[model samples]
Target: MTIATLFAAVVRAKPITGFIVEDDPDRPQLARSIGLLHLTMMGVGATIGTGIFVALTTAVPEAGPAVTLSFVIAGITAALTALCYAELASAVPVAGSSYSYAYATLGELPAFLIGACLLLEYGVSCSAIAVGWGQYLNELLAITTGWHIPDALARPPGNGGVVNLPAILLIGMCLILLLRGAKESATANTVLVFAKLAVLALFVGIAIAHFSAANFHPFAPKGMVGIGTAASSIFFSYIGIDAVSTAGEEVENPRRNLPLAIILSLLIVTAAYILVSIAAIGAQPWTAFAGQEAGLAVILHNLTGAAWPAVLLALGAMASIFSVTLVVLYGQTRILYAMSRDGLLPKLFQRVDGRRGVPRQNSYIVAAGVALLAAVFPLDVLVNLTSMGTLIAFAAVSIGVILLRRSRPDLPRGYRVPLFPILPIVSAGFCAYLIVGLPADTYALFAVWIAAACVIYFGYSIHRSALA
Candidate 1:
């Protein structure tokens, strides 16, 4: 192959219209019973957990009481990419999410790399959240009962012990719920979403009563750099807002509902995060947050002089994080299923159970892969991978929005990005800034992964893809 031929092969793009397809009966046929409510809940359930539930300990110290502002800065950054997702999801409405958009608007190689990013964003994040779930479960256990899971079983390899039993068990349970079908899984997630919200409301209701204006003094004690860095760290919490786009096939009124759900969920999540951050910071001295893993619960415990509050918060974290793991894992499977259907992956991944209307094989494969990751790897390594993959995938989607607008303006969009070319340009640029801000080690690993994905695309995906 000459350089020109290889370049042509790599840049070949897919048709920029229609739902998921090659106009073949053998391809997947997903049921569309999910309404706007469930789709929005899917986004909320995926977004509102680990970052708020666990990461505050690290974030608050960086900015003092102004970590609340960090949440806003982080949210604005997420909102930019989210607008891109909203516009693309409205226009495209495919289960492949950003990857499908890239294939249609960018090129096969970019699409393949976006697919890789989605795996890290969804699968690795799922593993990391599940690890969080295990920790909180142990917290809940120790608070409610006299005992907790042994470290030998609870900790992941190299972190402390042989394996993470509780994390895998959490994934196993979610797998069972998912195999029941999409509607059922969404229903379960909806319930969990509400449960966690009520728990958060309880925390806020109690904590806000003790709000001291004095605590917010010297806000941004470490200044704007600290706030920005904290925002970068907590931006992962804003993820899963795009998880709504991954369920395009399973959603009713795809164009309207997908975009509506994505934006609405982000709005809801940002509001909740800001409210919680304000309440937590106002109720306690900023210096007191440095090492409190259960910060919010500790706030409650301090206010009421009780252990029950911490136990309840622990229960909430466990349930809420379980929902995060479930939704993200679900997103991962649907993405691979789309890749397989497009011939970028093995056919086995696209195999759907006709009776269940779910890609059982894809779900099982993703769950098994992530469960193993959760059981063996510690959370520290996984967190940066999630952020890097997430930002790159988001950046690609922002770029895709501009390209698609220029290439196919004739297509009716359910939601047009408010500011047109400028919004998409800035969205992509912000994503680039965040990606560049990631640690050097993270950048090196991300480059390696992209390189490897390019090899797979050149050696296999290029030839295998019908769309390419």
Candidate 2:
């Protein structure tokens, strides 16, 4: 191909309002049935998983009692990006999350690249949370029945054991629910989110009753450096806020519900995170947080010598992680469906079940991919990479907001980011700053994933693109 032809093929942008072409009878379109409540539940279900439940062990050790400060910093960064995402979702309501926004604003090449980054964010998040579910399930079973799942069944290869059966089983369960339909899945998620919140509230209530002000001494023992690093890590907990946007096509009244869900999800999750961090730190010395496989349960165990609180925490965690896996898996399948519809991926992803009005095959494919990772990879290996991917995707959405504002000022936006370009600029900058704090290996893995995506784009997608 000539240089001009190559540039034209790669840089051509999709129209912001043209993502869903539902006129064709044979074409499978996602069903729009989710209301505002369901959308918020999705955001909640996807956002509050392993990050708060399992990550405290690592985050507390890094920042001591001031990990609460880290939670605030991370929450602020997420709020900025969530606002940018809200504007984009209102302006260009589509199924693919930031990838679709990039396609409509930044062109096809960037869309393909952003789509790959989202795979890391959502896909790895599903795996990591499912692995966490395995640990919590073991704890619950051990407490209730005196029999824990063997390490060979509970752990992944890198974690010094065989396949993680419970993790894979959890993914399979979610796959079945998603294939059933969006409403069923949404209802299940809503129930799980409330249950998860109740358990968290119980923990905070109990922890506060035992709050020892002395445990907070030397609050910044590790200094600003540690707080910043811990903020970067805690950022993972905020990953699912964008899942609200990913369901644009499936939501009722997309323009209105999308932005409301995004904002509320951010506020709710952030407040819970800050409160939980404070209660946990105040209840016990920060030093006690490290090396606990299930941090919250361990905290409860310490506080009440009775095993019941720990058992309750474990049961709550199992339900919480299950919801996370379901929502993250749902997000990934919807994104892939959008990409496939645009001819950037195989047609298989976009195929919906006629009776159910949901993408059964796509859900299965995503579940298998997530299950493989959950069965093989260790938790730490999956967590940092997910944070790196999320930071890049957040930056892309922030930049897309700015670009869309400049290019399509006349376009009707249901929600506009206040202060013009300021929010988008700050959001992008903050996300980039967090990206830099990640381990170098995470960056290298991201580079490899994006490079592989580019190669696929050139080799197959370019020739078959719908725009072509």
Best by TM-score: 2
Q: On residues 137-225, what C-alpha lDDT tens digit does candidate 2 reach at each position?
A: 88787777889889998999978789999998999899989989998999999999999999999999999999999999999999998
- Which pairs clash (backbone N, Cα, C closer than 3 Å) in model 1? none
lDDT of candidates 1 onward, in order: 0.85, 0.89
* Displacement of the residue 324 alpha carbon in candidate 1, Å: 0.9
| Model 1: per-residue Cα lDDT over 174-201, one tens digit each | 9999999999999999999999999999
The TM-score measured for candidate 2 stands at: 0.98
> Number of clashes in every candidate structure?
0, 0
Q: Give the TM-score of candidate 1.
A: 0.96
